[model samples]
Target: MNKKVLLVPLAAMTLSLVGCGEPDVDYTDNTRLTMRVHVDEGSEEGNGYKEIITAFNRENNGKIRVDLEFVARSGGIYETQLDNDKRKNTLPDLFTFDAPKCAYYAKNGYLYDLSSSFSTTEQDNFVALNRYQSKLFGIPIQESSAGFYYNKDMFNRAGIDVSGITVDNPWTFSQFKEACAKLKALPGLKGAVDMRLDATADETATYLLYPFIYSCGGSFVDSTGLHALNYFNSANSKKGFQFLKDLLDNGYTGTNYGAQDFFTHQVGMYLSSGWTIPELDNHVKWGQYFPDRNSWGLLPYPKADDGTAVSCNGSWSYAIGNNPRTDKSNVVTLLKYITNAKSSKVITQHTGMIPANKEAQVGYANPGSAEDVLLQQLNKTSVQRPETVGYAQFSSAFGRAIKYLKDYGVDKSVDDAAQYLEKELSRLK
Candidate 1:
């Protein structure tokens, strides 16, 4: 037998003896809840999830105790664990999942229907965008916006003006390309942009191509089924793909670069989320490369000719495990405690992510913090990723088009890519 299993009976005896001396709060009398946090162990934001759990524990006193489980960053592994837990009927009382994955769980009946649990008053407390995006799946605990974080010093050295840029006044896609061209022409900065295109990392597809698809008014799904493949083959998608291909073809982006790698080299500009700010702050010594700390600034994603400034917003949601023994009422109570407005603010404050609740945003205003500025800018112009079932498969299909474009350039035939995407999308239905 495992040594840990052998010690369990002794551990139970010790707990009994310890219980005799302490006042036992009958949390079970009301609702004994166990919360399991599904987190990516390697991420700094993962630590923030633990901090939020710690804050929740301290505030709950003895009324509730949560158990946290850290998961590997791989989405496939995370899904596998969830599947196993569901089969064994050992689902956690509560858990966290990415927005798109949560949508799949909600659609498949694997997660509770949170739409009924939130009151009108509570629902109204969240940002309008978040309310509209995540209403049915799970409460959003944190939010981050996708955009370009550029080094102003690099821009100035390249004779590119930063004065007219604002969150509300972001450049058009054409203008963004022009600026990048100028930056690339600079003496030392060979690669002026970081458009993540690696197939191995999901961010290339999620943070890069997803927004482009949206900006072009194309989508990964239609009434019939997943349409990402068809969408990418469409004339509009082809144009968008060609634009990105042109960038890579012209040597505007770094060689062998993904999002993380590009930023690590202090590349001219990077397209990523506000959540990256904290990591950059810790990793890059600002004074070493740039003259001003304020040299790094974020802007909304550039628009297409139609003037739609598109951006992708991703967030985490609290979920209930499929465990049969968990009391429904207890689970609801636990969800309430963890996703409350104050708790949401604590998460935002610590993690540099936007609070899911609109009321929680009030805490960030007037703070003059970089995160606050990013959140404020993002709120005005952002859209959530498609929260439908089979989103993973859909996103994967979409990624293929990106890879093709990045590797072969726009000169390659779109017909093959389109046919493959359509075939893959057919499976989602």
Candidate 2:
């Protein structure tokens, strides 16, 4: 058995060793180094990370010792904590950050460019590595993609056949609406779908909903990565938002529903990510509504009449801070080790997330399985959120637009939302 590592308080390690190694050091150095890694506390993902760190510490023994530290992760708490650390110049040697924040952190000089840490071939193995200004700033801990989860039993009873649907040949917007009409007419279901509108208050809103815009040929910004006026408010963008509003107008789905409505058979479909698998597989109430995993199936995101299928992608990642006192080589070693194929596989198995390492994704190779559906969409059809320093503001603007569509109706909402996005973009300038 491996020896245990004692947890360290982030406050205790505020003063990182400065000027010890100065700038870059040899990547192969075997120096005895002490490091601290900070991750969000209280999550299954966190547990998986702890396991990786413990195994790493045991393997390296006295040559390298890493202490794990946890900080609050919900309701902007984690972002606030990191911001405070930045101001104090007490950031940890290495830390976890959301992929969308890559530009913000790198532009602020809080992160070190890791482009040289891995060769081109090795870097290609990761599905998504956070980059800014052509420099790699963070490596993905895992990858993510979202799709519609349908109750197979519900579809069967509603006389809907989804057997022919797939990432390449997904349902069109009209077909999806027709299916929703049929499913909502079934007995016992409150609605045809649960879009999880409650997620609007956080990043989950943008992560899951942005694909709608893409499916309809809408973009948040232009090629220059600096504007959202016509791009965000274009005719195509309005069509997508209008489709969502039509669903509400037709009473196919609503803002009010239990978070587990889909799992409990209260809704025919749920828009969610791979993270929902663990709950569906092991929830205490699983036996009540779902007899087995076969009771449900995964569906790719629907496309517009003239567009192709699309889904959202990205997740949290590990990044090295620009603390000159810390040994760059040591932190890079820890980053590569924890995100390797073996370590990634372990985390994916524990969290139901897709692994960042392509090699680690072998576990999902079973064709036509639910897990396989997600993996296929991730590899083939998913797109990343805008990688801009202004992404946070853009997400907020889009989220508010969603709410407006539901409350004030479509045309005004689309125009109003686009105007808001324009205003936010101007502020970023």
Candidate 3:
């Protein structure tokens, strides 16, 4: 995509007024509620949520109006907005949040208790890992998993097999490393893989380090209040850190490729969200030179030596704010409408994101649909990221550790790093 055209944040442009006007007079009297929904600018144009909103308005006759605000991809900007809103006690009626941050919001009592509102049947519609307790904080909107996306043509040129293996049967960590080495050794082939070690990439921490931590059975923040820095220095975490460092040391990765650049240039394998596949397929140039039309393939993160498969799932949820409503019933009705099965189908179809509702998943898995193959692959494997209030701090600490390991190499002593990690982990308590 053109950076100048595509780089524009959805929020930067106001919603076109054509054909959309304020609710008519009588419709407003039934129950007037203004909800601010945070959405990604990328999804703003053909977002599934728009269908849900439209269905909701039709059903309710415009009693509830949802105002969506597209947030930039910048973490700092989003955090600042949330913090400023929280301090002013002026937050949106509904917003979307992912793991770690969701845990933080729930822990701080910033969201409404949604457990009673949804049924066991409704909750069961979501994958087990996607659901959370603690006052039933938020409703899972779209769930996503992270993994390696390899160039089939590149793999074939190097004579590497790219068949049958999926998120469930991904290569072992060692196998993954070897694959990278083989690719790197191939004459005239591009680099083996692009692991995001660069500080500038937003996802360096979230997508890259978390899987390593999970693979080693290390928690970002332990119950006793340990953080990433503390986890990094531990013996178990040392293995995970070494795994990443070794990749960098062995020439499998470098600072050149973040998540976005990996697939775009067809450079070695890339680690990223499943939603990225559709966007990647749309961008790549294809022909005789690019023999692999289905040039991309998905696999879960490599397994640990003990054979445990782990991958992180990112879920954006619906949360209600503390605003008092004259007609609370209307608010609940709106919530149900937005999260209903029909809305979920639209979301899954358009965005390629896994639906939070079981019924909606069927739509993606219908015969002949590319999504069907991906859904079947993801369902058997994939897990939600650790949900904890100190996830942000944990992520930051882990990112720093990754950078340190990449720069210093695996041979570096863990003493200083471990000590630094332990101190940061203690702050979560």
- What TM-score fits each model? 0.80, 0.87, 0.79
lDDT of each: 0.65, 0.80, 0.62
C-alpha root-mean-square deviation, each candidate: 6.5, 7.4, 8.9
Stretches > 4 Å off in candidate 2: 1-43
Residue-level lDDT of model 1, residues 1-429, one tens digit each, is 799998999999999998856333233344455565555655665676677777777777787666667876464787787776676555666777777676567655567666777787876676532222345557777777766778777777878886676666767878888888888887765487877766424644565557775677765555434554555566676666666777787788744665454344446788776756765675355445443447576666777766476777766777665455434776777777667778777777767778877777776754444565567655776776665566666566556666666556653545555566567656666
The lDDT of model 2 is 0.80
Relative to the true structure, candidate 3 reaches a TM of: 0.79
On TM-score, the leading prediction is: 2
For residues 1-429, what per-residue lDDT tens digits would candidate 3 score against the true structure?
787876465434445543355323222242555454455656642366666776677777745655556665464676577666666566556666664466678666567667777778877776642334545767767666666777776787777775656555667888888788878977653468766567523554566556775677655445534444445566666777778777877778776564455545546687666665666656444333334536566655787776466666556677776443333566667767767778877776776788866677765655423454456545665555655566665566555566667557643544455565567556656
Which residue pairs in candidate 3 collide? Answer: 226-425, 227-425, 229-421, 230-421, 230-422, 233-418
Model 3: ten consecutive residues of lowest lDDT: 21-30
Off by over 4 Å in 1: 1-30, 40-65, 72-77, 128-135, 223-225, 258-266, 283-286, 322-327, 365-373, 407-418
Better of 1 and 3 by lDDT: 1
Query: Deviation in angstroms for 196 in model 1?
Result: 1.5
Model 2 Cα lDDT, one tens digit per residue, 199-259 = 7777776788888888898887775455777877788888888888889888898888789
Local lDDT at 247 for model 2: 90
Error of 1 at 140 (Å): 1.3
